[model samples]
Target: MADQAISGDRVSGIEDESDLKRSITGKLLFFYVLGDVLGSGIYVLIGSVAGAVGGAFWLSFGLGVAVATITGLAYAELVTKYPQAAGAALYVNKAFKNRPLTFLITFCMLSASFAAAASLAQGFSDYFSQVWELPPPLMIGLLFIVVLAVVNFIGITESVVANVVMTVIEVSGLVIILICGAIFIGEGRADFGKLVEFNAESSPIMAILAGIALAFFAMTGFENAANVAEETIEPQKTFPRALVGGMIAAGILYVLVAMTAALTVPIGTLAGSDAALLEVVKTDILPVPLALITIVFAVIAMVAITNTCLVALVTQSRILYGMAREDVVPGVFGKVHATRRSPWVALIFAAVVVGALLAIAGQLAVGDPAPGEEKTTALEILVNVTVVFTLFIYGMVIVAALKLRGKDESEGTFKAWTPLLVFGLLANAGLLVYSVINDPTSLIWCAGLLALGGVLFLLERAFDRRRSESV
Candidate 1:
């Protein structure tokens, strides 16, 4: 059955004939999903979740893992049914066959990637600040994006290899936090009672819901794995286990890390901090020197952020390249570099948009606020925008999965339980609606990004019409 699908892809000139190199094996792909899912969100947003739900924030992580896994089941089934890049957009296009709706979904995915990369870049700057007080954070973030772009331009094999190395370093940092927490418990200093507590200001239900919205960011990069299907070796055989298995592993680690942070540090301290895990390390439970551990963990946090950002760039480029092949966007985006075989045009475009977003966000966040004004930072705004965009995309993917069910009932193709996909769709919709209601400002950012996508869509249509007339 797998052989039949591979031959069909070649004859139909679908993804198997793609110019992108197929260097991602089952092992590399496993690390790719694990690394991407375990990236910067936990490092940077753990405090935000703590602030929302107090010491019991690990419950939110647990719930988020459940929601994400449900969505992962949908992705596992769809990628096997129609193994290709473009991820959600491709699935939607196949299910609905609506060009405009397909373009909207594609742009939403692209915009989400842009916002996520910018958010991670901000996180990288925050961690870099802990190491040295050299350049301003905005400058550091801009430079970070440029360096990752260069790494991406080199090749997918190189990029995935880098992600694997960085994944190890970042996971080590989390393990250290867990070890420190255990030591604190053994010393009879931990407040295990706090683990069940919720924030006093909000109802327990609201607090948990809000924390899940933020924690969902940590579970996102799993879907990005779908965009690399064309580059993966034997995707039908490799993706189901790798994608779902990686998410389960990352989810367990996230919940454990959250528990450790709450155990080792005071809830007030963890809630107040931006680097929550670093605070856990600062408990001095570990025998290492305070300064040495702090600096080492800071470097590890930056590496984690870099790994996620690199995978995002890879997803964004593949999205454009895939859509272009379908004539849903400009043909130029479909062009691949001769020697490198990378989607050079799409890669550069994604990098520039991310850099521009950072610059614009920095400008908007500039200037001191009046007393008691409580200004929102660029990172906070981007994080909310990313969550909103991703939730909507996940919901649509589940819908697409339902629509495409039984369309290609080939043997060896994975199938998610129908009822689970329905539940996942509702969960995503609930979170998305809740987020927009609480933070209406995110809607404005989403609107602006979608408006830009609309403009690009119109321009592409105009260009295609002109080219057709000349021919």
Candidate 2:
């Protein structure tokens, strides 16, 4: 299909008509993208990626960022063309006009959001335990979700503002890691040779690919920005730059952090701990008191996880609200609070589901361990599930972008390179297949979630039928 263009005037008209507050400027949107992309995945899963790729995990992060950026370009084009909320589902609906497919995509996005939030909540509890002897980490994780929901319920402006502050703090925490690594190197304790080493148990290609699958989690939050496109001021002009720019910036920081971690600490130490970055803070080369820095770093890591969870909730609620307006889901999800201007019902539902996920996942044993592999935790299971769902949604979005080409011909609409979108689709598919093959448990989790979506879809359809019969 031929690509189309969208005029600036139509885009402006759509933005002016949005119900959500347009409080997010170019600056806030930049941080929104940055904060989301730089979230808890790195803080929590750096160890998992290291385990997959050995000491050369930074390469996985770099390649993951590159693929995510390519996919982000496709989103940049679609969001500017459509300039509305609901993200991937919205794009897919526009391209295909199939209700079942649209609802499935919507549910996939929602499911991914729930899993991501739950995983981050787990990460938060992991860090929180360092500050206090918080037994029963699951309870703490549940409370974390509740607090985020409350923050989301207040309003969008308040939520994004808090996101900005948290983003700054998280970036500072990462910067501290870089600084400590520099000092460690100067002291002659760093081992730079590990930067090129791969896991001996697997081929270099398999190892790096596995690492990319985990590291891609850190690159995910950029897509959440598209769900708030309606609330972004002048989205067509603002989104392209902010979205792509934020992904690139976050990618660079991730590589640097990974390199520093690999050089400053032994690969075995990093690969074994859940709080891999915290191990960097514990490095004795720092001039300050070790305990003080460790505590401070833990707080910052919790803040970073909170920021990502907040963004994920925001995106989930918006997806429900947007899909409701399209009649792809129940109309109640579209209800906005009278004063708060937030989707309170959707927010509450999302929070409840995330809590349930945490409870259920905690009790259940997920995938079996491979030879020499340790049994997976609830957090790792959720992370793998989230990655699978996100990769599916991303691949669909690129295909949708390809299908929707030439449908919008107005001037000033952003367009992704056609070849890059194709490459992104293949890359996403490859990683998704690899994830399922490596851990079949992820497929089970995905199936269970999609089965839930299927149930909801049928119920919504039955309700619509009964209403029409009454009329």
Candidate 3:
């Protein structure tokens, strides 16, 4: 069992651990969930959805919200059911009890994080270009990683505080769009009916599903909150409410933001540039007399995403450390920070890997993919593979949900159950299949990463077997 501590003046002897406390209430949990799920996937990929689904971008976003909400519902159920700090990887380890299996799941989580962070850093670098023309994408990318690494190494307090401030700042951008969009629509420049335009001209299902992939990125951080259950005030009670409620709220906000953006800007335009929010501000659509307002919004978005990037790295390290502690990877990876009680070794290794990816992306990024050619950038190709790995990890968690049932019957407390988890797993698998067929770039990488994981798993198993025999 995990460590335990007392609450109030009660002698329940059955107290949760006070060491490494998170003090997360339902409200704060909501914020954590909201911030992660409402990630800058919108800021960076608004254009991607626009390009794919054309005029009905809001419909695409709405579709994304639905699909993510389905997965979110499953996550909420599984997390509430188990109430453990390990989350999906923990669940996988508990279910399989295979060192190699857990290692791969943990690695998937870590790899997905690096891929996402690389994307975020790429977004940051792109935005940085708005302010200054830096020729070196690699240098700027490394610089971004360094800043985040430093912040994470400092302490959890700094990371949380930074996330809170950045989330608020970024949320303000959406609110601005909401307000500006309201004004634009009221002034007769934008149309409300466009939000429901399931036109007969195109395959709405295909278009919407394709857009759902982009939206999924915006909704990436829901399961992450489950991993922090150990830190929360009350695992069984606090996590479920926060996890479910927070996701629903974030989904609503995303839909609103999408509608507002779609309404304020021309569909043709929104489909063209990723900086659609900036476009809305520069044009005379909204009531913001000053374009500086949008710039502030952009800054807020960047800060929120940066905070997200940092937190993700922190989560990835913890997952890797936990896996290593179970003897999945090696004893070396289980090393903890003597003073901080954090996973120093994993953090350093993760930073190195991400830095390497950024360096590669900086060197190889090109303007566009050609006919008979793949993406000209290493980062672009690698990012696709990362997404595949991420889906694979999420899929495992869904399966873990089913396997962990009755495995730890001693933890009497619970929320949702195994059936919901199975449902989620199936949903995720379906979507993953769709993504593999539609997005081949990510498909190749997913296969490669899993293959890489398979090789490492065998080696680790053989090494552990030798040690066991010697002992």
Candidate 4:
């Protein structure tokens, strides 16, 4: 097949008009990845990770960085090499030469994105309710999705500029928590030795590995960065640096926050509290009034969730638009707005799916709350599903990198280290197996979703054949 020209109006010849605007510069791309990588994962996954790894929670997060970096290298190489909007699905199609497989990978990315958006919506609603009484969480979550979709339909540059502002505010919140931890240490109220403590029930290595699997959930935003390649200016020259730099910066910041959290707060206390980071802030070290601290924490949590959902929705819509261009799904998804130059149809479709997931998941969990807990908390379940799907996607992407390693570097492309690619493959495979063992229900969800993708793939294929014969 011939490659498409780089016309502003058509994204890979899929649209009749010009495609998404190429306004994202190197700096904007950096913040986009940084803000997205530092998203709801830290806000929601920290406590869950602490529960798994005890006081040595930093170890798990560090390990997650290492693993994410390995996979990130694969993404960097592939995104620069292809420089398209499809991301993993595009690489898979190129390497494997299988249309059905491509559709499956594309759908997995979209579904995982929806899961992330849905989980973040619930988080937003949960925190919003803390500040003010609200209607049912499902309604609030749906409303948030609708609002995000509107912002997305407006323009990519506008969406990403808003993200940069949110990213700064969110990072500032983490900085405040770090300062509070330092104050506690100066007062000699906390034991720094606790930073190395491991849970007595499990061996140290086993515990850290378990924590890595959970921590890996927070490390996934880097791949979504690849989905925006088509919208970035000079992606081949700009994406590799931004992607790797953003991941490394986010990892260092995460480790610092995890270490400060471990040293300043009791593992048991942090593990048990849903608002674990808030607990660190509300400690006497900050010297803020209780009501003021509560409001600050709520606002920060809402910003983190909003940043996450916004990025996920953007990535999901682009993936659908990419797949639509290939006839893997309906063509309407590839329809770009004539004036706005955005994938308006795909944007609305993604928002509706995310809203439905949030509504259904919230209702299901609400019906089965544990005593004293406000709800049954299916957020972790949704997060788990995303992790599983992402792991498989990561595995395939690494495989694609290996498959494409032989391509020339004449265009400034380079291959990741073979050992790192192998290691990433093994790590992803191991984590997928472990996740299935721990939460078998996640596999059922993955299976059902993949099956849905298969049905759509067959339909699109048949439709293409008929259209060709008619022509």
Candidate 5:
């Protein structure tokens, strides 16, 4: 009954009569997924992966793709079944019907998006600083967040097109790295054996698992794509293909890029630098001009950061819009601009949080050292929280998929394998364990965030009761 033959296209789920425009085709949706999935994660997290697994960093990325695939399949099933916005939070609400849990999941997702946007803003500042001296990086980073917020408020169609352009620019950087590695190997200066070598840090299995925990963060932007399903044309048909195909493409690209990085540069060198991918190009192995290549890297790095930030803002605002519609949050968040049809109120709120976080990261980057503190940047702390909360959200989504299975047999044509759903649950739960073991600080940060969600939920309930009494 859900799959009505609407003009023979086999539409499932209620058609969205929202202000959101259905301009996203299968091709545009493909680019959207490709762009979001191929975000700053690979550009920024490669060094961390190398630090954990040494030269065999590709293994971690490979495992990350496998883990992401399991969840991606679950997402494909649910997004098509629901074919609405709000993504993971919506799925959670449908399965459990628990307001508190749904609020927590939704809040955690918003927190993750703000943290991710801040991280990307800081990344943009770092790369821009490489090209020109920034007198105050914090101010520059806040400016970046502001720019993204403005774009997000304009319209979804415009935002996705910008993402497509930026995606092309960012993917070019990876292609160049691969070509440089090929040239290096041809000259017999690269060590092909390092491709399989793991340093003496720990057992190989533990190292790969550790690396997978970190690498998993790089593959997460795919899930956020579900938030835009409402804007997608024939979402039930296109979402599953875009979500799964995009992940596969990004996974292959990640593996190839990781192998090239390990083969072309020493693991120690790659592990030490935050801008490790740039090192591959600037190395003597490549005959390109150092200044030209550095500038190119700087430009592409900014593009990557901006692309990810834009997509994050889009999803975060949509999640807020979805929550507001459900009365899980303030109704103001659901308001769409009359002309642009964008979630302007939600965009403003998301921007304020992201901008504040960026300012904090900027201060942490430049402020004088505390007496004995390790001088960690706010971006570093927030990225860890983002990873932890993201895994938490993913775990709940897989559970929701299992619970909702067969409940609506006609809701979606695609069904995730039950075994894979179980695997996804274990994998996400295992990653959460690894995250806590590796960085216990994440547990504290996530706890604080969840507590804030609880407080907000109670406030909303009280306000709703007050309004009803007045009536």
Candidate 6:
């Protein structure tokens, strides 16, 4: 059989496209999707779940898996169906047949991508801080941005290669955690009951779903895989497998990890710091090797997540380029780098914007005077708002998958199974609804941002028309 995917085991293809023109081996596509979806969200957010859900921390993780399953099914069918390079933007536009709707989906994704990048950079700063009493997060975030930019500018191939290696190492660390937890069970320090119970149910169904939304954040990167459809070999088949598999794996890991953490360490200790996983390894239950393993996992986890974020940011720039290609913005932004075959202009611009956001987060965390003043609180506020914004975009994607069921088979392979799309949209919509109800303030902020984005998108079109009329 001909290959239909890009990254061999890591999922990058030779030029990474699918058509009558290119194909990838199914297994290679599976691993590529696996590596891509398994990036850093779960590693970093484990602490947050413990903080919110108490002793039954795995419940939060279980919620994430359930939610991800619903959304993953939707994405699988769509990627198999459309196989377009445009991803969420293209799908929604096709579904609604409205430019504004398309533009909104693209804008929401770009903003959410930027926020996610910023969050990762900030998280990177936190981890680095644990190792080095080094300079503040601002300096760290800046340095981190510089490091990734240089790597990205080198070539997409290099970055993808690095991503694959990182994915392997990170998954190894998670495996080590399970092994260590098993040892703890032998030592008799582990409490199996706390891990099994869902005592948090007293909080109401909506509250539980609200916690699930945050937990759902851990299972995110799968959708962004679609953005690489242009760079995928047999995207139609490969993306569906990778996206769904990655999601399911992450969900299971999160649940098991949460269970073990609850069993060994008290919820108090886990919630005490951002480096919650570190606490688990340091406890009397496991020896230094486990902690050491987690430290290694930390490196893989952070780099992998960072790598995923870089891919996502690149997608955001592509949308900008696509908009420019459609005359929605200046044509110069549309030109791809002749040498690298990457979007150089968009890359630089996105790096600067996201770097700025990270800088703000750094300043806010430590109570710095300048942007730091509002940076911490504002970022916290935006975190929840970003949840709403991202889900809204996802909801659109689900709808888009349903809408494009009958496009030209000449266009791609793997059209979404229609029933799955409906199920996925409702899942996404449920999360969106929970986000609004639980944190109405954040929802308001998201709506305002969308309004602002709407105005800018429309004005860009208006300005383009004026320029055309003058010509």
Cα lDDT of all candidates, in order? Answer: 0.85, 0.86, 0.67, 0.81, 0.81, 0.66
TM-score of each: 0.90, 0.91, 0.84, 0.87, 0.88, 0.83
| lDDT of each residue in 371-394, candidate 5, tens digit only | 976455555666777888888889
Candidate with top lDDT is 2
Alpha carbon deviation, residue 344, candidate 4 (Å) = 3.6
> Candidate 3, 267: how far from true, in Å?
2.7
lDDT of 3 by residue, 412-448 (tens): 3453555656665676676678778876757555555
For 238-295, candidate 1 gives per-residue lDDT tens digits of 8988999989988999999999898878888977775777889888889989999999
Per-residue lDDT tens digits for candidate 2, residues 142-249, read 999999898889864365667788889989999999998889888887777899999999899999999999988889888888767878888888999999998898
State residue 266's C-alpha deviation in candidate 1, in Å.
Answer: 2.2
**Span of 10 residues, lowest total lDDT, candidate 6:** 372-381
Where does the lowest 10-residue lDDT sum fall in candidate 4? 10-19
lDDT of 6 by residue, 1-471 (tens): 345534446645355222356434444445555565555466566666665666766776687677666767767666676667677777777677897777777778777777776766766666666666568756777678767665676665344555567667667767766776889888886777776444354564544565577777666666766665655666665676767777777677777777777876777776665666656666645555654655665675666666666666666677778877886656656778777776677777778867876665455455654753323243344456567777887787777666666664444455555666677678778888877886677656556556655665677778788888999
- Arrange candidates, best lDDT first: 2, 1, 4, 5, 3, 6
lDDT computed for candidate 2: 0.86
Q: Which residue runs does candidate 1 get wrong by more than 4 Å?
A: 1-23, 156-160, 231-234, 366-375, 469-471
lDDT of 1: 0.85
Q: In terms of TM-score, which candidate is stronger, 4 or 6? A: 4
341: Cα error in model 5, Å? 4.1
RMSD of each: 4.4, 5.6, 4.8, 5.5, 4.9, 6.5
Better by TM-score, candidate 5 or 4 = 5
| Candidate 2 structure, TM-score to reference | 0.91
